[model samples]
Target: MAQIGMEQIGVVERVWRYPIKSVGGESLRQADVDERGLVGDRVYAVRDARGKLGSGKNSRRFTRMDGLLHLSSRLLSDADEPVLLDVDGTAVPDANGFLRSYLNQDDVELAREGEISHFDELPVSVLTTATLDWVRAAVPDVPVDERRFRPNLLVRTPPGCPPFLEDGWPGRAARIGNVRLTFVRSCVRCVMVNADQPTLPHSSDVLRTIAAGHDNCLGTLATVAAPGAITVGDTVALESQDAL
Candidate 1:
């Protein structure tokens, strides 16, 4: 097997957590990492009457529903109450009522994550500037923002590295500040990337380019091997499991 050695790739450029699945995320200056991932990340999801969570795409776990991307969710009142906020930052008093009307479904309601995982895949979604740079180069016309690809931690990889550097990190363990992570696999691209956001517009070219050039995969999904506090400037390092 090829050797995996300790290497400093970059520092955490940004940290994000989605209080609700498939909605606008909350940016963080520092976050407390835990086994489930950054504390309160994807802690809630909108559930349809059929029990599928509302998301940008349909699957056994999620039902593709419009308007979720148009609204954002926030955890307030000590997280006992979660509210859906509009573009004007006004909290829709009745989250479930608003969801029912906005999604055009009678039984849709906002629910917290329970036995079923709210995540599309793994706990922590990780990305790097290298891949974002590659996306820019591949489709210059498309916006190459990290918001286009939601991640818990965005790494600013060292200069002179090629794009898609995280593709090779699976099965390896990484450290960010006091937290340690084990890369599970590369994150597969989906229709969510094409969904519109506050400043980002809907674009199909982004996915097409990834599908054609990078096998429709970007970033990495990781599990917290060791938990602690991590900040924006935390250093990221990759090494073998033994190094943990």
Candidate 2:
């Protein structure tokens, strides 16, 4: 069997969690990681009439209701109740009404997914600054923001390395802080990447560039192997396959 060599690749530059799926995410200095990924991440989602979780994939619901991205959600207190905030930072106590008004859809409902929340694929998504820089360089016309990718952890790769290096990390194990994660597969790009963020307009070229340059994948999906706390500035290192 081929032995995999491990090395220190980068530091965790940013940590983000989305209390509600398909909405804005909140940056964190530290977070608890468990089998389901970062605690309180994607704990809630809007459900449509067919009992489908509202997502950018189902363009009929998400595209028309894309305004959900303009809203921000936060989990408050020990109860972990999600509090919705409008663009003006005004508290919206009525989540259903707020979603209904913003999405302009009467059938949609906002609800919690409890312990095992709704996830499009894997529990955690990881991205590298190197990959982002590469995408920006590949598509100069469109604005490339990290928010468009919605990654859980943004890693700052070591200096003087090629972009998309993480593409070869599948089936590999990585250690971030005290937590260990096993890479599952490349995260497939969706129309969500092309959706407009706060001030940025929707640019299809973002996904187009990814599809053309990187096979429509930019980051890697991972699952937690060990539960622990992770914070910004944490060192990231890949585990040797032989060590397993």
Best by TM-score: 1
lDDT of 2 by residue, 1-244 (tens): 2124667888899999999898888889999999989999998888878766776666533434567777778877576778888987677979888788788788888778855448878999999999999988877888786899999999999777788878878888988888999998999998889888687678899998899888899899999999999899998888886655
Cα-based lDDT at residue 48, candidate 1:
83
Best by lDDT: 1
**lDDT of candidate 1 over 1-244, digit per residue (tens):** 2225778888999999788888887788989889999888888888888899988888888889876777776665366656779766688888888788877899888787888788878999999998999998988877769988899999998898888889889989987888989998999999888888887889999898899998999999999899999899988888854675
TM-score of 2: 0.92
What's each prediction's TM-score?
A: 0.93, 0.92
Off by over 4 Å in 1: 1-5, 240-244
| Segments in model 2 whose C-alpha atoms lie over 4 Å from true places | 1-6, 59-64, 114-117
Task: Write down the lDDT of every candidate, Cα atoms only.
Answer: 0.85, 0.84
Model 1: residue 190 alpha-carbon error in angstroms: 1.0
